[model samples]
Target: MAAKPNTVNPAQKKKQRAFEGVCKSLIPFARAAAVIASVALLLFLTPFVGIYNKDIPGMEITVGGFSAALCALSGQFTNVGAAFGNMDIFNHFAPAHCKVLAACAAAAALCLLAALVLCVVLAIGKAPGLHSAAAVLQALAFAALIVSFAFALAMSGTRLLPEYCSGNPACSVRSLAILPALAACAGCAVNFAAALRYRKAKKNI
Candidate 1:
């Protein structure tokens, strides 16, 4: 008796080919977009949103966002309170809850940096392992941002010294603080989506 000849299913082969084609066509664009978004996120977090301080005449204290390293306007005062691991000037003067907010902000910043590095690697390399790594990093970054934003809201809602704000209208949380996290989240979404596509394409192929 003769054994049956090996065979391939035409329909399945066509479907797999089509899927691979789509993935190949779109993966590069997706990766590029993710890179752009990640860079934007880094820029937002670095110089723009980390601190916002406004000093006016006759105001004794400067008020603004509390960060882990230093206060927003540390330059204005002689002693800006303790450095990293402790409250800055803003946190010292504002409510205790500001410490929690500062910590969350710091964590988010670190996560964003990690995500940025992973994104750059993903864009440069096409290895299957790298894609998965990027996906996980982006997800973690997103979670960190969520926590940071939550703490920020809590600090803001409680009112960072109502008396200070009432007297000094210039002293307030800058809206820019939230923009970086938002942009970072957007970047994470793009990178994760691209990773998923790449994985699917590999599996299909």
Candidate 2:
């Protein structure tokens, strides 16, 4: 008996080339996404949610992640005296939601950090294994953030960033606070593309 020679079919070879090209092309995009995620993390620590002070420019009182958590728990929205009573009166009855916002914020930050690490690795080299995982983590980070703010608004009437309160005559809006979510959008899209590319490559092989 003689050994049979193994070879890849031309169609498979073509698919392989396409895969490699796509992956190579996406590297720069991955790096860009990593940088955007970094910015999101930094901004994540800043006060994205707050009430703009009309009397003083830049005096807009905002709370960062943790502080915002506390404010929401305390049912304080504006970070001012009268604002202590700003939360919906019904919110006063529910104490079980305590620490929910803080936990959500913490989860979002941690997930983003982990996703950022994976994105950097993917940007530096071929990390097909990490592509899907990274994409999921980044998506979760954004979702967690949304949940936190949604809870804040429904429970405490807190407004900032994605929350539109500009219509209020006495307050200003921090429209720029939406930057982190924007960054996450970039991060998620790049990783998703990378993941799909790898999946196709594996099937071809």
Per-residue C-alpha lDDT of model 1 across residues 86-162, encoded as one tens digit per residue: 23434544444454555545555566656666655555554434555555655565565555455544544444536
lDDT of each: 0.50, 0.63
- Stretches off by above 4 angstroms in model 2 are 1-19, 66-98, 154-177
Query: lDDT of candidate 1 vs native?
Result: 0.50
Best by TM-score: 2
Candidate 2: the clashing residue pairs are: none
TM-score of 2: 0.66
Model 1, residue 52: C-alpha shift (Å): 8.8
Error of 1 at 82 (Å): 12
Number of backbone clashes in candidate 2? 0
Q: Write the per-residue lDDT of candidate 2 for residues 1-205, one digit (tens) a residue.
A: 9888997789888877887776777687678768877987887665544456676666344446645444555655434443332222222332333246555666777788898888788888767568888889888878777766655444333433234444456554342334566677678888888788777766766
